[model samples]
Target: MSNTVKIQRPKIPQDIKPLDFCPNEENLFELCIIRDCSIINEDIHRIRFEQVIFKNVIFKDVSFKNIELTDVIFDHCDLSNTDFRNGSIHRVEFIDSKILGLNLSDASLGNVFFQSCNANLISFGYSKLKQVLFDSCSLRNADYYESTFTKVAFKECDINEASFERTPLKGIDLRSCTFDRINVSINDLAGCEVTSNQAIGFARLLGLIIK
Candidate 1:
């Protein structure tokens, strides 16, 4: 059994059509690429996207509540303050995206990768994540209250002041991540892998006076 954390990639077709217009009245979008477009002030529910690639798209005041995305790749997109609560995301990759203040509470993410993204102030409350990797992302002040994580990894991420209260870090490695202060209980930090410097900080946080 291999202990490596390998996330699945998006399975998009070789031939895809470009979406020129804004998504409206469309419940299910498949086999399409929405690039260089802006979706603003649109309130949509249960919108399903399959095999879609969103590149350089900017979203403002868009609410995709209970959305379902599969095999999706979001590259160089700006999804700041977008609401994606209760969404189901699988095999998705968010690369070089600005997701500041993005609300993903209660979302189910599987095999998802977030790389080089500005994900500060993101929320994952009550969400379930599996095989998720957040690499080189700014996750300052992010919330993960009561979230369930399995096979999740954070590499080279800025997680200062991130709240992981009630979220277990068992088997999760944070050696490559940098954080000044994070809200996490000692019990939740059990079995979590960290660097020596981080361990010293944790000891200080526990009020332990080390010689």
Candidate 2:
């Protein structure tokens, strides 16, 4: 019998199409499909999206403050430096995306899945994440200060130099990931799983001399 952990895949909606124009405050989107669009440096605020699907979209430096997204899926997108501060995201999946330096501070995410994404330097400070999965992602220098995580899994991810101050990571399995110089307190790392070599590195961080 195999005891390997399986990551959950995104449940994408079948009906979707290409979107041309950018969303506005007046015309809010609902149950729509947006694809192959570039919304660089656009400020999108107070918009509500329900069951929306975004595919092959590039959202460089886009501001998404206070947005409400439910059952949204982003596939093959580049969301570098996008601001999602204080947003509410539920059942959202980001697949094969470049979310480098993405700001998700003070946001609330539920049932979110990030797969095969380059999410280096991403910030999740003061956020609440529930049932979130990060698979095959690069999360170097990512910040999770004062955040709450429940049922979150980090599979085959690189979390080097990541900060987890005041975040309780009990029972979290980090053996499959690569991490070095991680900023985490001893209490925060309680019950977290690590490899033998990683335990040595963590011991070194605790001023232990392993001769």
Best by TM-score: 1
lDDT (Cα, tens digit) per residue for candidate 1, span 1-211: 1134799999999899998745667788899999988988988899999999999999999999999999999999999999999999999999999999999999999999999999999999999999999989999999999999999989889999999999999998888889988999999999999889899999997899999
Which residue pairs in candidate 2 have backbone atoms (N, alpha carbon, C) closer than 3 angstroms, thus clashing? none
Q: Model 1, which residues run further than 4 Å from truth? A: 1-4, 24-26
**1-211, model 2: which lDDT tens digit per residue?**
0112333443545765555756665747766788888877778777777777888989876787998878788889888889989999888888999999999999998888898999999999999988888889999999999999788888899999999999998867888899877999988888888889888888987899999
Task: List TM-scores for all candidates, in order.
Answer: 0.96, 0.91
| Candidate with best lDDT | 1
Residue 152 CA error for candidate 2 (Å)?
A: 0.7
lDDT of 1: 0.93
Global fold similarity of model 1 (TM-score) = 0.96
**Which stretch of 10 consecutive residues in model 2 shows the poorest summed lDDT?**
1-10
- Tell me the lDDT of model 1 at 159: 96
